[model samples]
Target: MDEPLVRWDWIARNWDNGSPLAIRTLLENHVVMAFAPVLFGLLLALPIGLACARWRLLYQPATAVMNIVYAMPSLALFSILLSVTGLTQTTVIIPLTLFSLAVLIPAVVDGMTSVPDHVRQSAVAMGFRPLRRLLQVELPIATPVVLAGVRVATVASISLVSVGALIGQGGLGALFTDGWQRQFYTPIIVGIALIVLLAVGADLVLIALQRLLTPWSRARRSA
Candidate 1:
């Protein structure tokens, strides 16, 4: 007899099995693996992006390096990282961080450049120092664009983290490999559902944050 597409019993059994293989554990791992890189990338990208925007000469070379890093195959990068980090989560995080930088650096540069020259001049006229202007004026104006890039990087990272399952470091991605090996559909379906849920939930939260932080942008759009 053929098996049904999903096994409720299997889900119930593993939902909180108190093991690393449990669904809840995998979900937690997935969230950490997916989000940590974006956070780190943003922090790093801010300075790099600022430099690139401030000195347009650096933008081309920086972007070229990032693009090359992004184009490298994830599996190849994982294999290379394994020698240093072993089968640890760091192996996954390092490469994903690089990929996040690839997306985020450009976003940061664009957002910074989007600040109008007049606005910058006005800041100078208002006795704002360079650092103060960046923090209090330019960055606020650039929030919407930067957050847009963050949204893309976040969703992409969530989906890409599953690829790490090939090396036993994948979060929810382990479910995919497990189900495939066992010929069971339950874990695979559950993983997909959870990943989708996570991505959508994250995206909605970011959209809400963007609205909250950049009310003027929203109001301008509505008008």
Candidate 2:
């Protein structure tokens, strides 16, 4: 019987002998699976969120639907979607995308709504049309908040994508399930650590992006 490798030894060995699928390959696959859904969901949520922000009438209904969808278990949701999407990336992506909407939409609504009323008034007084104002002024001001939500949704999506391992669509999650079945702790522990690190790294990237995109907000706070 092979002896269980210590965590440090496992890392060193992987550098030479390599881990399953090559750690780099697994990492890349993980990124693809995790971020794709987030991007898709954010795109879908943006217009709906903006509409909700503009019209108070849409908020309650939007909130109700998002809440209901968010409440569904990720695995169960994937299972239900499997028949139609059928054991493909679509099954995984669709459910994860829907999950992301629960986070992204509220972020959009809150960020847009939180813009100061005076800001909107100034835009109107400046002869900015509604669409122009939303594109130029409002979204820029709301960017920091929306990005914060994106950061959260990205992290959550990465974690949930692991749940797809049972369906053969798991990226790094395959490591966890394989390790568990074989009683090998190295891959299981390594997979867990990598996922967490990915989440933190993604979050920091978004923070930097927010700062870069919202220079006026930073300048104001600095002043």
Candidate 3:
């Protein structure tokens, strides 16, 4: 592989230098197609996985589907869906969401399972209803672990959105394709660097959010 040529000056210029229209379009598309699916997957999977953990019968089916989809290689998933969905943004969204579910389900399940039974028993003894108990007692204790899973999912989605570029769905991946096609290394390098920045930045933001949401965990850490 003749490594792509990276021109720092050129990359810096393009990093935030595109026409206003282009910059806005990229931001809009990224949020709608890329961010939405991952967030949707998390929302759907968290409840399902938590419920499944408490109810064994649901576990087999949910985990089975997640296992099968997660086992599919990213490239294969893309290729197969591209054939059916015809290389549109939906093709990218579907597979990435599936990938997110696989990761998130396990995380949520593990977090929920780790909650001490004594806590649940106490909640029940206090006459707390099932949903109320889960919301107030179980979920609070599991916050740190569940947020760790979300951190993993957010980073993974950021990287995978690069793959969305192949389908002509715009994002940082556009830079990589442009570089490869034109043999201009700057775009590729810039794309990778920005992607890294996005992931790291997201992780930091999530960590802060997790600390804010799980105040007890933060207090425990300081103790």
Candidate 4:
């Protein structure tokens, strides 16, 4: 505890001007590294997920493949990518993108499927074209469930980005390696604590966003 305090103090003292390892830079890096992949993955998976929802045949196979990829060890995944992408951020981002896609795809499917059958029938009765209904009706109705999946992806991305430190690109994870190398406990503890805080903070922010966007969901809850 005291050690972490000392580290935090050191971090604060250097906060304003700590070159590459500045706490601010690290925090920003952590957020960027973690979120970039998730955003990319989510975008990629949204259509894929929707397709699966439409075509049941694609659903199970896609889920199975993603699950297999997700089951692979993170380090092994990184190492394998390293062989091709080398030490660039691409190595880190690609794996994480796949991971985020795995988490988001099922959630997207769930969200889409959760739109009650009656809702779809009503949309069809109202002359809502397929595209418009999907864009306006389905997406809005599915927002809460989709957001829940996004929360999972976000948290997983944040936690896994630390593993990048192994390949010299870990954001907040770099501090952990540095601390261990120097036999210091502060950076390690601080890194872990901050990572958890970051994950929780992001999750809470997403939850708030979900509430703000889905007024109908709140209305339903109140009723």
Best-fitting candidate, scored by lDDT: 1
Give the Å error, residue 186, model 2.
0.4
The TM-scores of all predictions, comma-separated, are 0.97, 0.90, 0.85, 0.92
Worst 10 residues of 2 by lDDT: 14-23
Over 4 Å off, model 1? 218-220
In the range 132-222, model 4's lDDT, one tens digit per residue, is 9999999899889889999999999999998998998888898889888988877787789889999999998998898899877954485
- Candidate lDDT (C-alpha), each: 0.94, 0.85, 0.79, 0.89
Arrange candidates by lDDT, descending.
1, 4, 2, 3
lDDT pick, better of 1 and 2? 1
Clashes of each: 0, 0, 1, 1
Cα lDDT tens digits for candidate 2, 102-176: 999999999998789998999999999988998899998888788888998999999988888888778788878
**Model 3, clash count?**
1
| Of 2 and 4, the candidate ranking higher by lDDT | 4
Looking at model 3, report the run of 10 residues with the lowest lDDT sum: 19-28
lDDT (Cα, 0-100) at 62 in candidate 4 = 99
- Prediction 4 TM-score vs. true: 0.92
Give candidate 4 misplaced runs (Cα > 4 Å).
1-5, 218-220
